[model samples]
Target: MEAPPLERKLAAILAADVEGYSRLMNGDEEQTLATLTSHRTIVDALIENAHGQIFGTAGDSVLAEFPSIVHAFNSAVAIQQAMWRANQELPEDRRMNFRIGINVGDVLVKNGDIFGDGVNIAARLEGLADVGGICVSRGVRDHLRDRVDATFEDLGEHSIKNIARPLRVFRVIFDPEGDPAIDLAASPVESPETSSFVEQSLSQDRDSDDEGHRVELAFWESVQEGDDPAEYLLYLERFPNGQFVELANARLESGGTGEHDPGIELAFWETVREAGNSEMLEAYLAKYPQGQFSDLANIMLGELRGS
Candidate 1:
């Protein structure tokens, strides 16, 4: 007699992994492990809050299943945003970026783990995501369209590895222009501030054509002057329904100024040294061969290695 059929169900699968896990590990295995552990706390919390379950995870890869496509997509976005916040306090080279992929498909589940082409596709799509970016399968994109209140860029069809057929993919652009809180309809639960902002914008009168042109000119001038995100944000607050709302939001998401914080770099270097290991010192040297703390890091590394 044939064996009983395997358990299967339609689910939203999310796959994510560190972009440069090996390089990080090579730099400092202990610190990499510690950092990964801390990051997992963030990832796991977001997944749980989204009502998803983590079914499997390796050193750097995570696979989870969600009952709803919207929840899964939202979880991916939340994870990315949270990671970005966490990285803000970290040194540039030590920042950990995650690539996430989401798909809605039939999956085989057993023993608290999931498998099937659905998972395979998600894994493949994760490989395509940019550092700190998310990619989703066609099913996810189709369902998320207007429901998510964000822009989706169609990636067209592509043949991914180990897949029998070509698959259509799309990327969720995390371009929050003025207010990061302007998540639109993407979030299932809206905060009072966001609701108020939406209501105010909808109720406000459209600027006169001439006024709009002047505001547009001013927006462009601000951009030309290299004003920071806060400046663009001020423009958005002043002209909620302005012609340049989209551009302003994009600039805000790009963080206006491209300068790195030297204080953060110094703090990160100090933290690494406090670990008191040759590997940590090596990591510091690797990231900043000629940086402010490089001389001390090099001396410590040499002393620790007796070389």
Candidate 2:
């Protein structure tokens, strides 16, 4: 006799995996295994706290289902935040970053494991998240407008693997300007930005403490000399706990290049001029308080009173 059809339901699903699990394992198998085990323990607890069920897991990937979309989104953010805190003490290479994706849709359930396009889409969305970041489908984002206390930025439509239609994706902005390694824009598929960062750091690894210190000094001096935000970001990616991490972060947040993009400033002005509303000027100031035309924007804001 043929088996009966599997149980099915609409649910919110989350998929997550270590961003550089393969490379980390290849670099140090034993240590990688231990670290993954520890991280899984933490993730499992967080999932439960959010009232989600871990339906499946692979070597380094986690699949969980939540009854509520908000719960699932909150859980993803919490997990990343917790991992960020835990990673503070770990060295650059030893630190593990996770990419998470959440979606809400119909799913097939059999023997407590969830399947179907819902799960598949969530997994694909995970591939689009930057290291230590979250990406959610339009379905998930739709429910988060007033429910979650967080920011969601539209990533526009993206073509994902195995999905015929392009998915409307949004990035869950946990910390917009905090860490470049974690805040960089994600590509449709996994981008090499984070991986290249990891590879560069790995290549600089040294067996001698003296040699490693010298290398660290060399990188630090390079960043100081260049005074480029990208160089500073690279420095932080390689040495999360380096002596200049705090300074680097401050520079990136303060527009380290010493100026805003002229194109961006011009576009902001154009937008405000076309709209001719206080709201638009307010938005301009909010995004760029010290923008090239801040004074003009403020004057416009006052002129368009109560707008």
Q: Which candidate number maximizes lDDT? A: 2
What's model 2's TM-score?
0.57
Clashing pairs in 1: 148-186, 177-249, 178-249
Question: Per-residue CA lDDT of candidate 2, range 49-122, in tens?
Answer: 67788978889999999988977887788778757755654679989889999999999987667889999999
Candidate 1 minimal-lDDT segment of 10 residues: 176-185
Name the best candidate (by TM-score).
Answer: 1
TM-score of each: 0.57, 0.57
Flag regions of model 2 displaced more than 4 Å: 2-5, 176-307
Task: Write the residue-wise lDDT of candidate 1 on 18-102 in tens digits.
Answer: 9999998998886676567656766776787677889888889999999999889878887887677666555776778899999
Residue-level lDDT for 133 in candidate 2: 92
lDDT agreement of model 2 with the native: 0.73
